[model samples]
Target: MTLETSVGNTQSFGLSSKYVEKWEKRSSIRTRPEKKIDFELDGFFFPEDKQPVLLDGRLKDISIENKSELLIRSLFKYLNDIVTLEIKLINSACNKIIYNDLPVAYPEQIKMNAYTVIIDEYYHVYVARDLINQLKARYPYLTEDALPDSDSFCAVNEIMKRLDAEHHDLFEIIAVCIFETTLVKELVEFFKSESVHPSIKNYVNDHMNDESRHYIYFLELLQYTWDRLPDKARRDIGSNIADFVKMYLNIESEKEFNLNYLDSIIADHEENKQTVNAIYKGFEVTPDVPIVKNVISALKRTGLLDDENVKSGFTNIGWII
Candidate 1:
C-alpha cells in the first residue's frame, strides 16, 4: 500500500481486526522481492549530499576511489544501524507488548499486531544484511568490525540507565514509538535519491513499506499507553523526551565521528589530513529538521505534549517554540 493510503491521521484510526488482517497481508516479509538485488556499475552506495564531509565542498583533492569508499562505508554504517534499531530496540519493546509485560494492558488488536511488527522487523534486518553482504562481496575492505557505532542504540541505553527498573520497558516503548514515526520520513529520503543504486533504493522501498505500517502501530501504542499510564509514570517518561531527542539526534557527535573516520581513511597524506581538520573546524551539526518535526508531531498527536512538564521540557530545549 502507498504511504498516503496506508497512514491516515493517528487519532482517527484504531487497530481493529480488519486492520490487523490488512497489515499482515501487505507486510514486506510476505510480499516483497525474494530474489537477490544486484547493483549497477555506476550508481552510488550512499548519496553524496547525505555525507556531510563530502557535501562541504572543501575537500576537492580527495580521490574518486576514496570518495567511493566513504560512500560505501556510509552505506555499511547505515545498514548496521538498522540491525541495531530493529533487533535491539524495536523487537525488544514489541516482545514486552506481545508478552503482556508492560505496566498496562494494550488492546487485543494492538497486542496481536505486535506479532506482525516483530516479523516485519526481523525481515528488515534480513534485507539490510543481504545488502550489506552484497556490498562486501564487491568491496572486500568493508568489514563488520569497521562500521561506525550506532548512536541510536547507545542513546536508548543511556536513557534506560536513568529510568527506574520498572520504567525501563515503558521508556523503550516510548522511544520506539518516536523512532518508527521518524524513520518513515528518513526512509523516503533514501528511496527518492536517484544517485543511490537501484538495489539499495529497492531495499529501502521494501523497508519503508513495512515501516509505514509500523509507524501507525506505534502511534496507536503511544495513544493507548499514554491514556492508561499512571501520573508518576507519565511525568517520568514525558519529562525525558527532550533529553532523548538530544542524545538520539546527537548531530555534533555524529559529525565528529564521521570526520574522525574520514581522517583515519586518509591518515598517510599530510595535506589531506590538514584539509580534513579544516573541514571539521568549519562544519556545524544541526538537528535533522524533518525528523524533529515528525517527532514533535507524534508527541502532540498522542497528547504527550499536552502535559505542561513535557511541553516545557521541549520548549526549554528549543524543540518547541
Candidate 2:
C-alpha cells in the first residue's frame, strides 16, 4: 500500500482529490440498486464454515432442525455485531476526526474523506439492520436479543487503562486505524462463499466496497499521525500496540460468547448441551492469523514496526513469531 509519512511541502495526504472523487461512483449509498433484493429462505443465512458450531463434529449429531435454527440465529448475531462495531467503535472514531476532537491535526482532505466514511459506515449499519428485520419477518420464531458488547467493543476500556487521559484519543485513533486496516479481509470469505444466499453476498460486497477504501485511509492517517509525534510519544504508543492488539483479539471472550450462544440455542436439550460443552473444552485455541498478519502488515506499511519497542512488543506477545 502506498502511504504518506511526512507532509513536507505537499498539501494533500494520501486521500487526494482523485480518490475522494471515486467515492461518489463507488460507494454503496450512491451506487446501490434501487430495486429491493429478494432472499432465498431455503438457502443458508450464513456460511457454515464461518459458524463454528456448525463445523463441530459433535454438533452434526444434533437434529437438522436444531442446526437450521442455529444458522438463522447466527445471522442475527452477526448483524447485531456489525451494528455494534459500526455505531459504537467505527463511528465514534470518525466523529473524533470530523469534529476536531483529536489531539493531532489532519489535512482538510483527510477530514473530508472521514465525512464520507462516516456516511458509508452509517449506511452499512442501515443495510445490516435492514437485513435483520427482513430475516426476522421470515422467522418470527427465532428471536435474537441484543448481544452484550463484544470483546472488540469493550477492548477500548482495557486498552485505555494503560494510557494517560491525554493520550486517550490518540490511542483510540491508532486502535481504530489497526481495526480498519485489517477488517476487509475478514469480510471477503462471506462475499465469496457460494453456500450463502445471494443477498448475503451482496451485503458483504457492499461492506467490502467501503472497507477497501477505509483501510487505505486509515493507513495514511496512521503514517501521517506517526510522522507528527515526538520520539518519546512514538515510543509510548509503539510499546503499547501489542496490548491493544491482544485485547482487540480477545479469543477467550469470543469463545465464551459463542458457547453461551450455543447453550441458548440448545437450552432444553440437556444431552446435546452437555455434549457441546465437552466438545468445546477440546476445541483448538487459535488466533485469526490472517487478521493479525494484516495488523502486522499495516505496521510495516506505515513503518511503525521499525521502532524496536514496537517490534519487541509484538514479538513478546508472540504475534510476530
Candidate 3:
C-alpha cells in the first residue's frame, strides 16, 4: 500500500502513477463484475449502540420493543444519503476536479490515479443504488425524503455552500475526501461489527475494498496541495478548512431530525413521549464516537491538524479531544 506521511509517498509506485495500474490488476472487486451483490436486509441496520436511541422494550409491547423492524426501516432511509450522496460527491463534483483540474495542476503525479478514482467511485455509487432499489422494493417507506439531514447529505451540502463558486469543485473534493477518510475508519468497525446486517456488511466490505486504496490518495492529494501552495494561499485555505470542518460535520441537526423522526412514527401517541425522548438523546454526537474519531484521525494523518489555526478551530468546536 502507498501512503504519504507529509514527507512524501512511502513508496515510489504511488508518485510514479504505477500504483493505479497495480491496484487495478490486483483488485477482485474491480475486476469481478459477476460477483453477486446481496440485497437482503438482516432485519437490523446499525449496531444498537450506534442507533439514535434505544428503549428497554421489556416495559412495552414485545412487538413494539423489538425495534428490529423500525431500525431496519430507518437504515433503508439512511442509505438514501449514504449511497446517493456519496455518488453525488464523487460523480457530481470530486471526480470532475480530479479528471479536469488536478491533472492540469499536478500533471506529473495525477495522470492515471485520478481517473482510476473516478472509475472506482462510480462503481461504488452503482452498488449503493442497486441495494437501495432492492430495499425500496422490499419496504415501501424507503422514500428519498424519508430521512432528512443524513450525515453525508448534511456534510456535503454544508461544504459546497460554504466555498467560493469558482473553487466549489475543489472544495467539494476536500469535503468528500474528508468523509472518505472517516468512512475508511468507520468501515473498519463495520467489518468487525457482528451486529450489522449480513447483506449490508458484505456491501460495506466491498466498498471498503475499494476505499482502502483511495483514502491515501486523497490524504496525499492534500499534502500535494499544501506543498505546492504559497504561504498566504496555504494559510487562507487552512483557516477556511477549519471552519468548514466544524460547520460541515455538525451533528445537532441530525439529533433534531432523529427526535422528530420519532414523532412521525409515534403519530400522536402521547403516552410514548418519554420513550421517544430517550431515543432522541441517543443521537447526540460526541467527539469520541467511532465516526468522529475517524475524522480526527484522518485530519491528523493529513498533517492538516498540525496547522495551529486548524487545530484551534477543531478544538473550539469540541471536535478533537
Candidate 4:
C-alpha cells in the first residue's frame, strides 16, 4: 500500500477491496517505544553544530555551543507546541467524522476507520504530553508555559467562515487531511537526522509508522467525501484546500505563540531578535522542503489537485512548480 500523490492515481487504479484489507491489518500504536530520553547528550533536542535546524536555515553561523543548546531547547519547545496543536486538531477532526454524518461513500467502513484514527490520534496526544513532561522533569530548562496557539487555525477559519454554515465542517476535515498529509512528509528529515536525539527519533518513528496508515486513511476518506460533494461545494472547498497547504507551509511563526516560546529560549528580547535573524537569515520555502512537496503530492494523489480551481490556486500560491 504505497501511496504516491499524483492526480488520477486513485481512480486510475481504484481503491479496490485490497486497500480496505490493508487498513484492517494496520499495526497498533501500542508498539511505540517507551524508552526514556537521555538528557546527557547536547544534540538530543538541538544540534551541536547549529546547521539550520529543521526548516529554519538561519542558524548556520551562530555556532557557539551555548547558543546551539539554547536553539535546541527552543526547537524542543517548538516541537511540544506543534504536537499539542496536532492533538487538538486531530481530536476535533475525529469527532466531526465519527459523530457527524459527512457524505462519505462508505458509512460503516468509514466510521470504523474513523474510530481507529481517533484512537491513534488520542494516543499520539498522550505520547506528546508524556514526552514534554519527561523533558521538563529531566531538563527543568524546557518550558511548559508555551500555549499551543496556532496561526494556521486562524487562517483555516478565515476561509471556512466564508462558506455557509453547512459546509464549515468540510473545511475542518480538509484541514486535518492536509495536516496529516504534510506532517508525515515534514518528519522524514527529522526521523532520518543522525544529529537528533535518539529518543526524539524513536518518538518520530512511532508517529511515522502510525501516520503512514493515517495518510492512506485520510486520502481514501478525502476521495470518498469528494465523490459525494456537490459541484459548487467541490470547487469552493477544493480551492480552500490549496489555501491550507500554503498556510501551513509558510514556516514562519506568528508573534503569538511560537515566537513567544522562541523569546523565552533566548532569555532576552535583544538576544531573541538576534537569534530570530540568525535562524531565518536565508529563509525561503523552496521545493526542497519536504512539507511543501509532499503536501502537493498528497493533494495530487487525492485527486483534489486535478480540480481546476485547486490546481490553479496552488499554482497562484507557488506551492507547486
Candidate 5:
C-alpha cells in the first residue's frame, strides 16, 4: 500500500499521530541496548569557553531613539533571513533524502518523515509570509530587499547541499540535529526575554511559542531515529553529534554582528565608556560571563550544544577545556 494509504487507514487520527504510532511500534520490538535507550539532555556538558556575554546594565538603560529603532528593525531583517534559511535548508534536505528513498518503512525513515511534517506545518509559507509582512509594517525601517531569496539565504543551504553530495554519514545528521534543534530552542528563549525590544519581543514571543512545539517534535523524532540505529551506527552517530556540537559552540562564540536593538543599545551606551567597553569585550570573549555561560549551558542542556562529544573533541583539538 502507498504510505499515504497506510497512514489514512490508521486508527489514530492527528497530524502527529501517524508518526507517533510508527515510533511506538518500532520501539516496542527493539531489543538492542542502544535501540532501547531514551535520550535525555540532563547532565549534558557545555564548554567553559563558549558562554554568552552578560551586559553590565539592563536593556532598558539603553536609550531608544528613532534612529535606534530603525537600526533595530534592520537587524530583524537579517535575523529573519537566518530563520528562513534554516527552515528551508532542513526542509529541503529532509525532502531530498526521503524522496530519493521512498517506501520509508524503517524507524529512522519515520522520524525523518515526522520532521518533514513538522517543518511543513511550522513553516507554512503563507503563515510565515503574513508574519513577515506584519513585522515589516510594525517596523517601518525594515527594507523589503533585506528578505532572503531562495538563492541568498544563510549558509545552511550550502551545508545541506554539500551533505547531500557527500552522502553524509549518521554523525553528520547528528551535527545537523544539534544545530537546528538547539538554535530553534535557544532563539525562542532569547526572544521571550524581557531584555529584548518591545516590538522584537512580541515577534520573538510568537515565534517562540510555535518553536516550542516544533522543538518537542524534533527531539522526539531524533530520539526515535537514534534508538533504531545499530550498535556501530549508534556509536558513530554519538561521536558525530559530539563533533558537530563542538563546531557549533566554536562558531556561536565568534558571532559578533550586532542585532538592530543590540546595536542601538551599544550606541546608547557608547557615552558610558565602561559599558561600551564591556559590550565590546563581551563580543570578543568566548562564552565569557555568567549570562553568556548560562545561555550556552541552557542550549547544551536543551540538546543544542554538543556537551560530552564536543568537550572531548575540543580537548583533542588542543582547545582549552
Candidate 6:
C-alpha cells in the first residue's frame, strides 16, 4: 500500500493521520552508509563474591523482618518524591515546546488528545511508584528504592540538550523516534518480566499500552521532520542518528553497573554501603558471554537494532565482538 493509504488506515485506529503520514515519509528517506564506532567492554562485569549481596532480596521482600519493612517504607517515600519531581520536569520541558510547534490549524481535539497522552505517561510512572510501595508492604525484601533518580533522568535530558544545541531541528524528531520510542518500550517489557513483583508487572503493563501509542506518535513525527529537511540536513540527521546510536549503546552498557543508582536505595546505614559495594562488585564480573550480545538481540527483536545502516555504522566503529 502507498504511504498515504497506510497512514489513513492507521488513523482509523485512533492515531492522527497527519502524524502517521509524517512517519511514513521519514521511513522512506534514504539512510547514510553505516560507520563502525569503537566500544570497549574490558572491565564490564563485577566480582563473583558480590553476587549474594547484590541479589539480596531481604530489602526487596520486607515482610519477613522489621528492618526490611522499614527499608521498604523508606524506599517508597523516596520513590514518591522522585516521581513527583519527574512529573514536574516532564511537564515543564515538554509542554510549551510541543504546543508551540504544533500546526496553527491543529484541531483542538487532537491537541487535547496529545496532551492527555503526555499526562497519562506522567501518571503511569506515578502509578508504578505506588505499585512498588504496595509490593514493599507485602515483600519488604523485594522492595528497594532502586528506581532511577532525577539525576538519572537528567542524563537523558543532557543528551537531549546537547542534541538540540548542536543539531537543532532534527534533534527532537530523532530523539523521540529512534531513542525514546525504543527505550520506553524496552523499559516497559523489562518491568513486566516474571521476576518483577506482580504489582509492578501490572503497573508497567498498563503503561506499556500507552507507551506503544506514544512510540507510534514519535515515529510519525520523525517521518514528518525528515520529509521537510533539505537533502544536506537529512544527511546530517542520518549522521546524528549514527552518533546517537553509539552514545546510547555506551549509556546502556553502564546501566548494568552504575553506582549512582545505588544512592536511591533506602536500606539501613550499615547495610547500605555494604549492599551497594556488593552490588557494584557483583556487576563487575563479566559473564562468560558478551553483554552486547543480549543488547543486540533485543534491538534485533525490536526491528531497530539490526538495520543495515546501523550495522554498517557499528562495523566501521569496530563494535563487532
TM-scores, all candidates, are 0.87, 0.85, 0.78, 0.77, 0.50, 0.50
Q: For model 1, how many clashes?
A: 0
lDDT accuracy of residue 264 in candidate 2: 66
214, model 3: CA deviation in Å? Answer: 1.0
Model 6, 118-219: lDDT tens per residue? Answer: 565566555646555455555645534454433334434555654434444344434444543445645554444333334334444555555566665544
Clashing pairs in 4: 6-301, 46-72, 58-278, 58-279
Highest lDDT, which number?
1
Candidate 6 overall Cα lDDT vs. reference? Answer: 0.43
Colliding residue pairs in candidate 1: none
Q: lDDT (CA) for every model shown?
A: 0.73, 0.72, 0.60, 0.63, 0.41, 0.43
Order of models, best TM-score first: 1, 2, 3, 4, 5, 6
Candidate 5 segments whose C-alpha is farther than 4 A from its true place: 1-63, 67-71, 102-125, 135-141, 144-164, 169-173, 183-185, 193-203, 224-243, 249-256, 259-312, 318-321
Clash count for each candidate, listed in order shown: 0, 0, 0, 4, 4, 29
lDDT of 4 by residue, 138-185 (tens): 667666555444556566667777676777777677777777766765
Give candidate 2 regions above 4 Å deviation.
1-13, 34-41, 55-58, 141-146, 265-288, 319-321
Of candidates 6 and 3, the better by lDDT: 3
Q: In the order shown, what is each candidate's alpha-carbon RMSD? A: 4.4, 3.9, 4.3, 4.9, 12.6, 12.7
Model 2 score (lDDT): 0.72
Question: Could you tell me the lDDT of residue 291 within candidate 1?
Answer: 68
Preferred candidate (TM-score higher): 3 or 4: 3
Alpha-carbon deviation at 246 in model 6, angstroms? 3.6
Task: Give the residue spans of candidate 4 off by over 4 A.
Answer: 1-28, 40-42, 47-72, 103-106, 254-289, 315-321
